[model samples]
Each structure stands twice: as structure tokens, then as C-alpha cells.
Target: MTGSFGATSTTDEVLAGVDLSGKRILVTGVSAGLGVETARVLAAHGAQVVGAARDLAKAKGATEEVRAQAKNGGGLELVELDLASLKSVRACADALVAAGKPFDIVIANAGVMATPFGKTADGFETQFGTNHLGHFVLVNRIASLMKPGSRLVNLSSSGHRFSDVDLEDPNFDHTPYAEFIAYGRSKTANVLFAVEFDRRHKARGVRATAVHPGGIQTELGRYMTPEVLQGLVDSINANQPAGAQFSWKTIPQGAATSVWAGVVAEADLVGAHFCEDCHVAEIVEGVDIRAGVRSYALDPERAKALWAKSEAMVGERF
Candidate 1:
């Protein structure tokens, strides 16, 4: 399974000949890019997909193609969700829980990156609140909906290499604010969430994993200027082996790994691990080439610490 796919593999290619009939998937952030593509491919493969977005109108418009292309009894539905707001997260999770429909997979795919320092509606740092804590509450609230054998895929990023979670000053009140540092902390939280979640649920046959979708020119980078992006690429390239250069992946290729780990790959291969390029990632340290998961991101102790801090921040325990 690992050799069959790589950085260039597209979602359609990874899922070719795979039938997802009777499966129900929940994907957040369907208004654009990877979320839309991931929902489309899953629906096209005969899975019923419930897509969540901050703007339902935008999501409905963006997902028209997903509905049209659905086959073999597959379909798509939309729900309103604003990950930055815990009220909305709880409401969305409550609605799903009330409906009593079990989900085969839950994809925590919505996130923000490198934004000017700000706070979420709940008064926490924006990146940490929205990217990590938002999904943290949402996923944990509805976790019971995922039966044994189900999977949870958190959309983390290579940006995690920048830093690990700062449990003591997660809101940046005592620390100086830096955009990518906050983004890195949030992404690392994403991985730790998956690691701890997998540990908590795996005995029941439910597993969770995080993925880096590769560098893509998506709305996720809307906050970063062209100069900044080029500088980043240059930095990554500078750290690569001789003659190797950094390149962006298309949205399809970017999303391939999420769907691959969610369904196509064996549960044992991906459970509780960080994944990239459609396979489980190696825990490499002291490198800056934009490949491999950072060892700190997968630390069980760090994961547990984050979980406890998240509960305190969100005022709810899973």
C-alpha cells in the first residue's frame, strides 16, 4: 500500500476501483480546496458525505459538482460550522449526535494559517483556538458517532516542524506573538490530538491519524504574501539535498493522503501515526527539508498534556 502511492498520487488515483458504498463520511471546510475535493471523491466512490462549512451558501455552491457526480447511491449534505466559535462547534456536533447516524470517518479538515495575531470568539489565540481547539471540541463531542473500525483524520501540516504546543501560555498572553510560530503550535496540536485520540479509542477499533497535505496553493495560504511564500520555498529548497528543489502539489495530490489514510490503507499501517505523501511518515528530527513528522508532534506525553490543557481551555472534558 505504501509503494502504490506517493507525493504525486491524486485522490482519484488512490481511490480508483475502491467502492465506498454504504459508508458515511463527515468532512469540515467544504467551501474550498482540499475539503471540497476530499468530499467529492468520497461521494463519487458511493459514500454519503456530510460536509461542514462556515458558510453553507458558499459550500452548497462549491459542492454542486459533488452532488452531480455522486454514484452508486452516494450523496452529499451540508452543515453550518464555524470552527473558531465553540458555540457553533457544539451545535454542529449536537445536531449530528441527535441525528443518531454513525459516521465511518470524520475529517477535521478546516483550519487557518499565518494570520495576524488575533483571538477567537472564545478569547484564545486565533490559530490555536480555531485549528486545534475548535476541532478538538467538535470531534470529541461527536466521537461516539464513530463506531468501532471508524477513522478520524486530522489535517495537520509540515508547518508543525516549526514548534510544539505551548501548554502553559497557549493564548500567547505571556509570550510574544509570531504568526508561523502560532501556526506551528496549532499544527503540532493537531498531531498530538490524533495521537492521544487514537490511544483512547483504538481498543474499540476506532483509530485516528494526522496528515500533512504537502504544500498547495490553496486558500489556506491566502494570508501569506507572494514574497513570503517564495521566501519559504527558498528556505525549504536551501535545506534540501543537492539538486533537490521545493515544489507545490495540486489540490488533488494534496488531499490524496487524507483519503488514503482514512480508507484505502490498512488500519494498522496508519493508526496513531503522522502521515504524509499517502503513507505513514518517519519521525525525523534536526532537519528542515519539509518532509517527515517531527518527533515532538507524536509524543504521547505532549499529547496528554495538550488534551488536559484543551479541556481546561474549552471548559469541557471528553
Candidate 2:
């Protein structure tokens, strides 16, 4: 399936010649960027998409194109989900469960990037809580809605290379707080969550995988100052081979990997692994290049430990 796709593939290109007619998908963060693009392409290809966002009015406006382009049996529905608040997360999951509609694919796509240190409504560090624990509880709470043969696509990032989950001080009570470090920990948690979730549910045919959307100029970078953004670009350029400077992907290209992993890529190839550029990423370590996944992100034991820690932090067991 990935034979012809790469970093530059767009979402529409990935699903070309494919029919999604009766498939129902749930995508979070549909109010902007890749989430909107992902939902639009899938619905345009004939899949019913349920979009979740913290702001309904914003999402309603953002997804107008999705509704306008929906075809065949495809359609769009809106739901409210504020991942920073456990209360909101649980409420969203409960409402979905009560609705009793099964999802063929669930894309945990909403997230925050580097932000000043803060805590969630539930008192977890903002990045970890919003990016990881919020989706953790919501996904687990709604896991029953995902049937056999279903798949879960978690939107992780190469930023995961920044740090692993700091289980001992997740909230940074004793450690210094750094925005990118927190973002990295949460991203790593995203991958590990997929690892453990796939382990526990693959037998039931529910597969989960994580993907990096590559560098895209999205609202996800709203928090970064020009200097911060420039610093990152400089770092990438410094690490690149001569004349091969880093570049940003278009929104369609950024979203390709998510939809590819969710629908186009073979389940066996993507399940429980981290992917980028529409293919399973190789595990590279002991270097600082802005490609591939880190070994720690795919470690099973670390994934299990993070799972248990997540359950405890969320006060819910799966």
C-alpha cells in the first residue's frame, strides 16, 4: 500500500482509487490543520467522520468544507472534547458510548506543542495531561466502541526525540520544567500508549499505531515565538547534509501519514509501530537527526510502565 507514497504524498493521493463508503471514523482536533484535512479527505472519500473539538462553534466553522465535500454515504458530526479536563474527557466518552455507534477508526489527533509550564484541571502537567492522559482516558473509556478489525491512530511526533516519559516526576514537582521537554514526554507517551494498547487489544483485532506528521506550519505552533521556531530550524539545518536544508510540508502532505496509517497502510505493518512519511519508521538512536523514531519510544517495558502509570494518574483502570 505504501509502495508509491512518501514524505510528499498528500491525503487525497494516499486514498486515491479507494472507497471508504460505510466506514465511520472519529478524529479529534478537527477545528484546524491536519485534523480538518484528515476528516475532509476521508469524508470526501465516503467515510462518515465524527469530529471532536473543545470549541463546537469553531469546529462547526472549520469543518464546513468537510460537509460540503461529503459524498456517497459519508457525512460529518460534531462533538465536544476538551482534552485538558478529565471531566470533559469522561463526558465525551460517555456520550459517545451512549450513542452506540461503532467507529472503524479513531484518530487521536488533537494536541498542544511547547507551552509554558502549567497544570491541567486535574492537576497534571499541562503537556502530559492534555496530550497524553486526556486521550489515554478517553480512548480507553471508549475502547468498547471500537470493534474487531478497527484501528487507532495516535498522532505522535519526532519531538518525542526530546524526552521519554518522566514517570517519577510527570508533573515536574521536583524537576525543572521545560516546554519542549514536556512536549517530548507527552509525545513519547503517545507512542507507548499505542504499543501497550495494541498488545492488549490486537488479539481482538483492534490495532493501534502512532505517526509523525513531519514539519508543517500549523496552528499547533501557535505557542512558539519567532526565535524559538528559528532555533529549531537552525538545529535541523545544522544536522543536515550540505545543501539539504530542512523544509516544511504542506497541510495535505502533513496529514497524509495519519490517514495512511489509519486506512491505507496494511494493519500488520502499522500496528504497534511508529510511522512517518506514510511508512513504518526505522528505529535510529545515539544520534540527533530529525528523522525516524527513537528506540525508547518503542520499548515494550517502558510502554507497560507508562500504561500502569497512566491508569493510576487518571484514576481509571482499563
Best by lDDT: 2
Model 1 lDDT tens row, 1-318: 544899999999999989999999999999999999999999999999999999999999999999998999899999999999999999999999999999999999999999999999999899999999999999999999999999999999999999889988998999999999999999999999999999999999999999999999999999999999999998999899876677899999999999999998888889889999998899888548588999999999989999999999999988
- TM-scores for the candidates: 0.98, 0.98
Off by over 4 Å in 2: none
List of clashing residue pairs for candidate 2:
none
User: For all the candidates, what are their Cα RMSDs to the real structure?
Assistant: 0.9, 0.9
Candidate 2 per-residue C-alpha lDDT over 1-318 given as tens digits, one digit per residue, 9 for 90 to 100: 666899999998999988999999999999999999999999999999999999999999999999999998899999999999999999999999999999999999999999899999999999999999999999999999999999999999999999988999999999999999999999999999999999999999999999999999999999999898999999888987787678899999999999999999999999999999999999977436878899999999999999999999988999
Scanning candidate 2 in windows of ten residues, the lowest lDDT window is 283-292
Model 2, position 136: C-alpha lDDT score:
98
Candidate 1 lDDT (Cα, 0 to 1): 0.94
Give the backbone clash total of model 1.
Answer: 0
lDDT of the candidates, in the order given: 0.94, 0.95
